[model samples]
Target: MVHPLAPLSEASAIPRVRRLSDRHIAVGERWIFSAGFNVRSDLADTGRVDVELADIARLADAGARVAVVSHQGSYRDGTARHLDFVACHLTALLGRAVRYVPGTVSDAAVRAARALRPGEVALFGNVRLHAGEEANDPRFAARLAMLGDRVAVGGFSKAHRRNASNVGVLRLLPGFAAASLLAEAERLRPWSGRDSGRYSVAVLGGTKPEKTEIGLVHLASTYDLVIPGGAVLNALLAARGHRIGASVLGGGGRRCVATAAEVMARTDRCEIHVPRRVVVAPAGAPYSPRRVVDLDDGVPPGHAVVDFLLSPWARDRLRRLAADGGRALVAGPPGMPTPAGTDSWRALGRYFSAPRVRTLLLGGDTVAELPYEGPASTGGGAALYQLAHGTVPVLDELARSAAHMSDMPA
Candidate 1:
């Protein structure tokens, strides 16, 4: 039951979860879509939520009653956030009324879903507000299952989590992989460990050094080379006793540096290319005449490493890989925007977007900065977690459920 596009090394181990399009989508059938609508404090970036639109629209167009359920904010912070704005945003994008169901798994929410007609869509309230969702309570799962006849998992970002909406609901109903989730699995083909025996490169960056360090270990196994940049590079430099000055460490502190050192010590599977020359500027201020100095030249007392310029040696390696038709993956921004308004994100963006290099970009900032018509994912954490570990928890549950219901049509 492996996906047609999934790698054998990984996919063969999991039971098949049928795609939503393959199911008999009958009119008036209730379709519960589990999606990730979590937003930042600023609420400006809705890409994670927006990516679910196509599949949601697909279900509605097929005359199915649709209910989108997701958490809205960081549940760890204990701050309750509503999905009122998400419903309104969807109404605008869909050009149709999307009823906002103000409770999750509550009697009122169940009533709202039960009242929906064919082709109608509703956005359920934040699932995290319910104590049972995060706990994956069976009773809560039964309550949510009452809203729909089938389940569609469209949130790849939450696939790794074991939550009521993610793993619990599948036990009670037919489950299928939504379009976006399938797209994510397909785009991650590079990390499938298929053993092409060819050159592949992974460029690691992003603000979270701890997460990036974990991905670096996994990326090294799948890719022939692992290149570090951004805060990840800063941590690596610090691990090797190089002075990084005032550059951001993503708040991981000494633990981050220790993790990087550990990775450097144990990583023997792939080549790690650390930038020797870097662009530097005064910390917290834009200064004229930016300096490109060697790594040996420690960052000055009041300065920080702004970006790393690829040496001819590293550039040539990438060029050779491209010539050999190998793939390249960029996880996060290689550099941050300078105080003076210049950005290095575009520099790496241009290189990867070239037609010759088969590229895939992960992370929201990566996709936002470089909008290319190729493999990309906005869920950096989930994307990396899957790449590192071959299976996602929710997807695995859905696969098992699909296998159990094999006697019935999808």
Candidate 2:
């Protein structure tokens, strides 16, 4: 099924083409680099080329003039010190000089770009600081376009959006997907086939619903959905007429629920599951045993449900369903303070991490909360399991896989 977020019209499917000669290069040459820079435990093998300081070093060593931009300043001091560490390591790896432009992107950033000769590198401050970046404003797109001669998109994590940097800038330049982008595409190729099944399950819940909504809509037709956690589940429950106390509308919360419902309506087979019981607490109190309430029992005013409470029967049913080797997608944690005692969180951790279960954990929080103590794989423990001896599609590469899948003779 076509992802809801996919462009309605298919653009020319451009196989990633490598520029072989400077003739292919244009004057005012620049390479616009961005990375899905979030604190992810399983990012190394997920096909996203996380822009690190070492990447800066590598670009510098190649003598490839580069300019970097991102939505947010990832590091505390704004120096991106960890990235700098990687850059320092890359310098040692390549025996080359690397330079980073300090401060966020602004008119100064534009001026700095103009000052650089071909082969020099500079990193701009977070792109997210500008509201237009997320809004996909044309003016912002035009401004970013000036930084590059040929834009090379390296950030696959943000590939689902038609935002200014990811898609808008591509329209104006001779652009191509970067090595990381291509690699991500190739990594998730297994899900394109018809045999992948229509009854797919997506485990959805996250601190940021807006980001998750993009991925969910894309995969909706391919999966039957499951939502967990205080925010996502609450929104879903609220949609079904359950009062979830506070609203989940801000910070991409409401958008997620609305998008999920749209996908479910479009694909008739979809179903959303919210917890039958929730652990609630008074507005300002810590989660305590006395505060938990059954949804059927009704919640008191000024109370919030903080976790899911599964009965033995429900746990058994979920376990049985998961154990059948059915396709499942897990995103977001089932509960907050996941390390804190929460039965639903523990149950989900056990169910998804079970060897017999065919589970794909999406989003950052889900992976971090997994109980596994050891380094399992580069794509995180859950991804490695889904990709282990079988194939699981990672979202960063969805576009490429969709292209390949659409090409099969039906």
Candidate 3:
């Protein structure tokens, strides 16, 4: 795979994004605003919905007809595929009625969008219900494009996707990115840059071992120290010739361990700390009472690693690192979101919360698992993708569309 980090000269070549703030919204103009509302399965917790809400209010309050477009993952095998829940939340948050359109890219949706007067807002149904939405079919893009005079994308979680609603629609209509989305990109960009003098540490872990490995390898180049936890901790242990027993090695299993070994070999610029004491349970039983075990003693057969507990000596090291006044970045949860696993996340959170260690948190699980909120990214996977790969699909589309608009005759 090509290295995700580009030379500074090459990075400078990427076009400047056209933001919604740069556009002049004429009253009554139709705006198809794509937003991300699928944070949790039940949609009970609105992660970063307020950001999109603020942008929508800007357009609606300016007398523009706003039509919201969004997609939700299939719940329990194709159940609960409507946007009414989001509409309800938006209505309450916006302090106004948010009309719910029954379908997307259908005649009824078009009619509802057309019927909306200036300053009114309506949310269309989940676009994923239609096959073309994910396929990025031009026909679907054209239909969605017709729903509005311009497109405003606010779905940072979906920025990595090349769907009709984001990438395809940009090709068919004038496109502008939401301020919140741009802000997310700017915040995550620093991790991929050249290392500075200030000490920086990255705590890398998550349910996805493969992604964690990728992040770990990249971060080691720029950070002063790198710590592995969660499934990543398991893989690194196996790489170091330790018996992890039946611990979760992720879906990749042996392959993940191999990659972890390779990453450890290549990353010589920074120090990597792999916790010796970990919380463990019976292989197939996560609900069982967990016990802390030292890796020096082999993990008993039929058991798996679940979480980590920093030894007192290691804790003192972190405290000293904090006192030096540096920065820290946490990408994923150090443990599973189980009663036993929460301990590790809490411990790491407390350490990073120190005033001297300015912390930057990324990934949804980190936010959901941690007790306190700091600066965080709502889209975990997307944020990781941008961090590793430099740019996302939505940002590229926004820049491309803006460039095309500039070249066109007035």
In order of appearance, the predictions have TM-scores of 0.82, 0.68, 0.86
lDDT of 1 by residue, 128-159 (tens): 88778888999999999988988889888777
Candidate 1 off by > 4 Å: 1-14, 38-51, 61-63, 77-80, 92-95, 128-143, 194-197, 209-213, 251-253, 280-294, 300-304, 339-350, 371-374, 405-410
RMSD (Å) per prediction: 4.2, 8.7, 5.0
Q: How much is 188 displaced in model 3, in angstroms?
A: 3.2
**Cα distance off (Å), candidate 2, residue 15:** 7.3
Could you tell which candidate, 2 or 3, scores higher by TM-score?
3
TM-score top scorer: 3
Worst 10 residues of 1 by lDDT: 1-10
lDDT of 3: 0.77
Candidates 1 and 2 compared: the better one by lDDT is: 1
lDDT tens readout by residue for model 3, 1-410: 11112122245233466778767667888899988776554665687677798889999999999999988873324643777878888899999899999678898889888899999999998888788887899999998987887888987878877889999999978778887787777767655544575667788777665455567667667677778887778888999988888988776677778877887888365777887788888988877888888899967899988788876766776787678767778877777667544677677777788887778877666777766667778777677667666778888788777767542211
For each of the candidates, give the backbone clash count: 0, 11, 0
Cα lDDT tens digits, model 2, 1-410, are 22222221122132323321212333345566655443323334332333344444444445556776654332223432223433333345445544455444567767777777766766565565566666778888788877755455555455554567765665555454455544443444333222344334455555565433544454444444454565666666666667767524336666766764665566343445556778776655535443567777666677766677766655665666566645555555566552365666677667656565555554345555655442121233223223222222223233443344331111
